[model samples]
Target: MSEVQVVRGEMQPWTDRTSPRPALAALLTDVVPANRRTLILGPHAPQLIESVLAHSADVTILVRSVADAQQLGEDFGPCLQVIAGALDGLQTPPYDVVIASDGLDRVLGYDSADLSWSERLAAVAALAAPDAVVVLGLENEFSLLNLLDSRPAAERHGDDEWRPLHDDPSRPVSVEQLRTALPWTAEVYADFASRTYVRADVAANARPGEFPTRLAVAALEQTDVPLLSPAHEGVDTAARAGLLGSIPTGWLAVIGAQPSHDIYTETADTVLTADQNLTGWDTTISGEPVPATELSFDPGVVPATVSAGVSVESVLFRLASAEDVPGFRKLAADLGDWVTESRVVLRWDDVVYDGESFAHGVSGWVTEEPVEKEDLLAAAWVRFHERLVGQHRRHPWPPWMLGDDLVSAWLGMSGVEAPEQTPATSPDTPPATSEQVARGKEIARALDEVLGTATGTVDVRTALAEAEAAKHELFELKGHVYGLERTLGFRNKAMKTRENRIRELRGQLQKVTAAHERIRGSRTYAVSRVIFHAAQVRKPKVVARKISRKIDRKIRKR
Candidate 1:
């Protein structure tokens, strides 16, 4: 909106293949406060900092080193604040919005060379203003195996590589024990983002040089530690309201799933041109609901399905549990798709890495007699639960019965339409109550003081109290959430059973309708033609045949 421009250093995507930073900047315009101190984390080019400047006045860019900061400052003088030091302990100026542009992904795992990505991110979030917004972006570039390749060759097996353990500062990991390693790191950032900063905004910036006029951005970063993602008043509105969300002290996370790193520019343009009504408001330059290229009963296509030719066709997994009743249908795929400039809103729980396991299609599911189960997705889900619960040692949310995989699925489930623009929550949220109003006053006062406080970053009670008051409000929301859950739980069980019945009835009805239609349409088909020519035949006994033969002989002689 600020006279957007992209100085293509490279032969900018002749199409929609531009750097995502600009789109990211546009999305941040909605989340970042009008103007406050802002922090940019990691080794992004100065271009991202320019994006921050476009939205807010007071901005600071935090780099890995002071030298980089100085150099960056020279490039974009006076407007930049660079902190050159160890990321683990660097002091950051107070900021309202923090952008981590594909920077944290570098330190995601245990690397002896630097602090773990989680450590750096959590540390930065702690440095932010209590209610400040942090926008952490990770490129879909690295693979899960990159974390496992830390093992030294001599001590590894099965594509073994030297693996570093971030949590265990003194220990190293073996390759076979790789599955356990990836989540611990993924979990850490997942936890830190959940804790330090509530996702206030989630958006996809465009691929640099892509879409000269319009860009494709997918946003899933919205948190609730006094954070929020506002549904804009008009359609195609990026993030608009709910300035904050609560990140309880114990644990929380923000997760996203990128189907592919290689996005199609031609496809995006085609879809963009096709969606004239949506271009103005609700639109996605590039998002294919189904994984584009399917495989030939390939187990690798769906690691969760594991066996050759054994797969899952479909299961009732959802994102928002409270999907409007009418919006959901047993026969239709009506789930919501967030495709606007900044539409896809995601929580910390939606993140899944390559190692976690997913199937591109439900291949290998058909057998002589297919093994159909109520929760067909459960077998693979066991590993998912183990990862979230056993591997990461995180809380088993969404009721204990729903393992990590299902819970993760629900965590990522989306709606048929973008969530309606509303206040962070309704007046029904805790701040509405008398006690809550008092607590809110307390929290705001504390927040004001904490931002100005010189020391006491971790020990800051005002921030913690504000977190607590909001948590209490969340507690109230949790109650209603659970109440809706109880009602939905009953509905889900009923629906599962109902789906089975509907399937059987539909099968039977299809058979009956096909048989009846076939018979009605076939010209040769008739009740009297049971034997094909039965109507032309008359009963003929052996004795009658003999008498008729003799009479025919006498008649012939006469």
Candidate 2:
């Protein structure tokens, strides 16, 4: 059985919580020399140790934690020699293959001398034979992941960061600096959490539709951190500007042995590798080839060459951001036609154009069931709407138009009406009822929650600013409404006063007309009218002569 050797300054009651990295294990399949003396400098995943053992029988692992060393000794039995001590205490022959993929930060124990990053790197190199292959992993302090991280400073710098020596001047920050610092020829890979690794130079020269760009984007999108911003957006922007390699989360440097593949990616069950030709990927599970039909999800199905062209979603983003309604509608119509003809339910981001026709860039998620064309279209558009709004992507659409309304508008633009009951079902099942559609949407939302795509926390500053603006707008609207109501009330009162006066005048005129008609209808008034007419008709001269004669006779008698 193997034995644990305790040297000077061993850390007690400590365990390195590093998890297994499948991509790193796959990389070791190519780096570890067969039957050669190998040394592992820090605590790594057990799977990686097993991989090293698979290649070389003579192996030794040095870890600062005594418990970890003892556990390693027990686990491997006679296959491994475990050393529990600080790096400075280890006294052994130079190894032909030295691997420090976990970095140098954890190699020094609490009781050991305070060493700078460069000094520790030099010590690791010193332990390597003249022609030894050294594999090193270095985390970047200024990586995009760290920049976009939304966690508090205290939470980010935990107990594990006791002596980070971040301000050391001799430490390498970039790939160029790292290459220059290494004594031997080395190949550097832009490592993304050990899930994906791409050649540094290739990633630096990536463009929007290229394989490197796609790989970088896919890797960045898999983050589960509460990011201040979307990681994929930053990756896309960096790739477009030809600066992707400059901001990788970490770097893996391999010296003495060259990697056969330019790219390495690890899924849950498989490792995918692509050579410089970039024609296709070679997929394996634990160094054994697996059939394509056995795989459930294949992330390595990106375009083989630049000729495959850009994704439809990319074009849609451009048009929507530019607020070119006409252009967006035209493209939507074309996409609708393609979907109708092909009857394939693929995501807009997965559908690419090859100058003449649309094609699926990734194929594993295509729907196998027969679904109505409109329903399929609605589902795709609805998903797009969710991502567009959830990611806070700018678009021409109004802010108030959301949920089904926004999805309907998008479907309308695509020359297909939105389904009344839209389903968000898996590719294998076709939705049949409204209940099913509702359940499907719920499942989709749940999936988003599981994936951490919907960050529940809003930016406190931005939310407060928006709330203040909305409150001010509502207050002004209320004041304007109050003024209009007051004016309307006064006008209504004046109109009622005029209406009452008109009614009073009409009553007085009716009384006067009744009195005149009564006088005209009375008998006395009729006789008086008859006498007046008689006097007018008689001769007034005869009456006056009779009166004068009578008056002259009276005067003679007197």
Task: Quote model 1's TM-score.
Answer: 0.28
lDDT for each candidate structure: 0.34, 0.74
lDDT string, candidate 1, 7-78, tens digits: 111111111111333333333444555577776655565545666687678766544333444556678766
Residue ranges of candidate 2 with Cα displaced over 4 Å: 152-154, 160-163, 276-308, 340-345, 362-376, 419-558
Provide the TM-score for each candidate, comma-separated. Answer: 0.28, 0.73
Residue-by-residue lDDT tens digits, candidate 2, 1-558: 578999876888887777878788888889888999999989999999999999997999999899899889889998898999988887787999999998887888888887788889888988999999999989887788888787875677677544456567887889999999888889999998667899899888776755566666666666665677667677888889988887888999999998877788765346767655443333333343333231224343433432346777778888889999899898888877877633344466657665567766533332334456666666667667776776667898888887767766776777764455656577865433333234335434443443234454444344555678799999999999999999999999999999999999999999999998998899988998978876785776786788789999999999
User: 547, model 1: CA deviation in Å?
Assistant: 99
What lDDT score is found at residue 180 in candidate 2?
93
Highest lDDT scorer: 2
What C-alpha root-mean-square deviation, in Å, does candidate 2 show against the real structure?
12.4
